[model samples]
Target: MKIFKRTKIKKYSKDGRILFTKEMKKEYTILIPMMLPIHFKFMKNILVKHGYKAELLNTSHSRIIEEGLQNVHNDTCYPALLVIGQLLDAIKSRKYDEDKLALIITQTGGGCRASNYIYLLRKALKKNKLEHIPVISFNLNGMEKNPGFMIRPSLLVQFVYATLYGDILMLLSNQVRPYEINPGETDRIVDKWVIKLSNELNGKSFFSKRNIKRNMEQIAADFAHIPVKKVDKIQVGIVGEIYMKYSPLGKNSLEELLAQEDAEVHIPGLMDFIIYTCDNRITDTKLYGINIIASFLAALLKNYLIRMQNMLIDAVKTQYIFKAPSSFDHIKSLVKGYIGTGVKMGEGWLLTAEMLELINSGIENIICTQPFGCLPNHISGKGMIRKIKERHQNANIVAIDYDSGATKINQENRIKLMLSTARLNLLKAADDSEAFLDNAQTR
Candidate 1:
């Protein structure tokens, strides 16, 4: 197979629309998947502010899965299917002119299927008779530079900020909700803040780091009064590819299901991705004979990410009280031993990284969610479960595969069985410990 390193073609034509333009009219629409709901909204508002019209398609849950199976290879990763299905669904909507539509998805250019997702999405579109529609693959590496879309540096910064915000909020909400006095208050709070911040970010002046810090602080302060239990509950960690961890659609809403089961969810937050990306750059330097400067750059980025995560921890501590067992140092320790840096980015090594972190933190039970057909996840997730469990006898793990053809009730039943075993083991351990203490005292 040949690899292409060039950016967008200098000249291209699709549906009679020429590539290259500073101005965008209502004629073109950009479509994105559900994981980027907030992102798409922010982009839409910003694009409209910049005089371009943007529309978002509602593509998530079973709809994305069904579309994926119908259009894409069953063996492909779920992200590819969901994304492709989203574009196909949008094109079929007939709300937008077919010739004026374009689909957009992030391209990380890593070793995983994610690198080929754009091409797959394009093929799916062409097969569906939507060949004229353009597929815009966004990459920081400048992989694609069509005139129809250009991601300004400022816009990228805002997108990063949005990811951090979304990730942190999701983390806090998961921890708070299981024990909240009002069951849905945390979710309501998240909704309120998402709207507030989305509107604030739409402005020209609110895109600075200083402002982002202030907003993070304000978000913490806003819901500071929500009541939560001070006692410890069963802490269950979530580990898998990035999508399964972040997007409910990808994992079949596994986090919510765990919360409903009265378990405190503890998945490593998004700041880890920043650390992982930096680490990858250093790895690239070693592999490609690049400069040591990449390693230095990675160290600098790690320091900043560590500092940011510390701030987030501080804020979360102030608002929602839950056990944070390991510091960044402890969590970082797991990254090297379990999953090496050579592992492809975005969910491959990251999932293994999080699983190891959870075990190190004394989180004995974990639910590893993988898309039904995601290959890398299968290898790193269920593939290594036996080894992880062998190392830690108390490890209670279950792997759930999500796809359109899968039934929800059946998935829940499997998780329930795992939870039952975990609970029983936990109770037996406590009893044994108490018995040993009593016998020692009597002696």
Candidate 2:
């Protein structure tokens, strides 16, 4: 006779939030929500390199929203609803073993609803009887701790470099994609670099400054070499809540739609947002007399990130075909009169700064996307627009609110109207230039 012993299953906690134990790290697959596709792809690769089996959820289906609305309150921030829904949708699909899975969500540890999403997700999981699956909060601040996952110094460095690389690739690709003589050439280059960079990040030269510079230069050069048509196109800039600005799923593929409308899209890179967050830490100390030690460390991190950004800019400057993003200092300076640095809720003053930065850079047409009922974004993003237009008369800005109920057709119609106005401005400018030339010739 053989005796069999059954393994014990842990009971749920009162709050349904369970800690991911170290033993779970071996068998659990962590699922990450997709935001900035290229960036998340690199981030996922970094996690795999560090011995975590990770997957970036890129599923864009109606059910994701449905699940979110069902789980979360409809009046909550749209981003919270969508993110929760996406995670739940994946779990219900039963593709992975429910007991052997974990979900990771980033927390800014700010005053925004984003910080509360992890708790909301846990509640939703409990509602669906899936509370056994642990949720990991991936944040720089010590907001939450997990035994299974830890971001060591080496891993953090790789993630930072990954972001820098992703930003450069996204910037250059956006510049060339609309103008490429051969369709798909720009994307092919992007795909190639993503894989090469992922492999290099796992190798010995990952931390080598020389190798990093060489990679950036090569990426810029490759994009520059792509055959492009020299035709005028509407230059549109996107600025708003972090997720809505970058996530194709969040904004209904705003970038792709702009390309179809014969427009060049310029999005402020993720590095700027990261830098802004660090700057806020310093701002807190100055404005509210917070801990000076934390402020000092924040300054150090901010400067380091600025140096990395400068390296990217230098590489892009070497290629005359692409226009690199402005430095953080330049972007920060633009918000001088419009908003104060002390406004640190949600996107805060950074949203206003990005809008001003876009207008000053000849990208006068802008789309400020935000979740419906998100008060902070409204105050900083849409509220600052009129003031910006008052100063820069040429600035054309449209604020779009994205919620589950917001129809795609209505949104597209509004954008099409904005595009019409942009076209008129372009034509008027060209005519004015010709008249000036004629007058000079007559003189």
Candidate 3:
């Protein structure tokens, strides 16, 4: 009568780190946070094709910010705050089956705070007692293991092609959309390609090297033919931290604002950043004792990406006036003394190189954006400004800080002031051109 049977107790994760289950394969949908709408739309297709219901949380409304503030620390980085907020807002929206819903966040597995966002997101999910949901860290580093969404060779190759496709799409769209004869025609062409490429990738063996090359050439020709109404619009180059440089929300809709003011926007391809991060592993091995195999692999992968990028750039050059971006090594050489590869704080010397690339390409007006109190940005961006300006006299560089408290009007006002100076110079140059032609005619 005194002997009692022992009971086994199971412990559940309170931090939303639950492993994705087999049942989730049937009904659960994966929610991915969006940085660029076009890129994520294509990426979403790839995920869905791979036997998962993947959706992009593409909203950038106030509600997202509100949800993020409630769950995430205010002093944390803005991109993380926005991303967490968007996901939490969706969770609390009462639209999805909570038990069948999981989240996928990109974990760079880097030295930056960005790599910790998955943990932050998990803590938030747990606080709301939604820890039963799975969190997948999307990365190539193989740092953190997830039972769900392993990257097979085919899947990995598809993703690399997706990145290359997104770059070409973004490059063509940004350059063409601003100067198109018919409003939204460029966007329509982009949407057409998005659907076409998604369908093409759905079939096995569709991502052949020959097919990829053909796709790039066709896309370049398609966008190049978009009837552009040429005007004396200011060409502005945007260089910033990875998030702010690309994410519309992270920069408070900076590209839209620039477009509204009739400025041609140029952003370096996302592939460069991917290559830069991979190259960092090699740099680390040299400086900090990673394995030789890892270093060799990193270098090999870096070179492969360059070949892909060069193919895309060559395709575009064949059809359009667009200038191809320099290789990673070329970018590094631009600021070799000013900053080093190991200075990899928030974009580090890459930010400096982008600015120089813009100036050399004749896009003299530049906007260097950063989150307020981002020390890496302060060190790499603002620190090297004077030298950049010293080298290029015509460079009109303005560094803008973005934060929760920063006003859109304030940021736009600063840009408007810069544009005012730019317009005057443009007009002066026009007058000089006419005068020189008249003198030549008289002679």
TM-score, per-candidate, Cα-based = 0.83, 0.96, 0.93
Candidate with maximal lDDT: 2
TM-score of 2: 0.96
Better of 1 and 2 by TM-score: 2
Residue-wise lDDT of candidate 2 within 54-170, one digit each (tens)? Answer: 989989999999999899999999998988999999999989987788999988888888889998998999999887788999998898888778989999999899899999999
Residue pairs of candidate 2 with colliding backbone atoms: none
Can you give the lDDT of residue 59 in candidate 1?
53
CA lDDT, every model vs. true structure: 0.69, 0.90, 0.82
Better of 2 and 3 by lDDT: 2
Off by over 4 Å in 2: 1-16
The runs of at least 3 residues in candidate 1 whose Cα sits more than 4 Å from the true structure, single-residue gaps closed, are 1-26, 36-52, 61-63, 202-210, 229-233, 291-303, 323-329, 404-407, 425-443
RMSD of 2: 2.4
Query: Looking at candidate 1, what is the lDDT of residue 255?
Result: 71
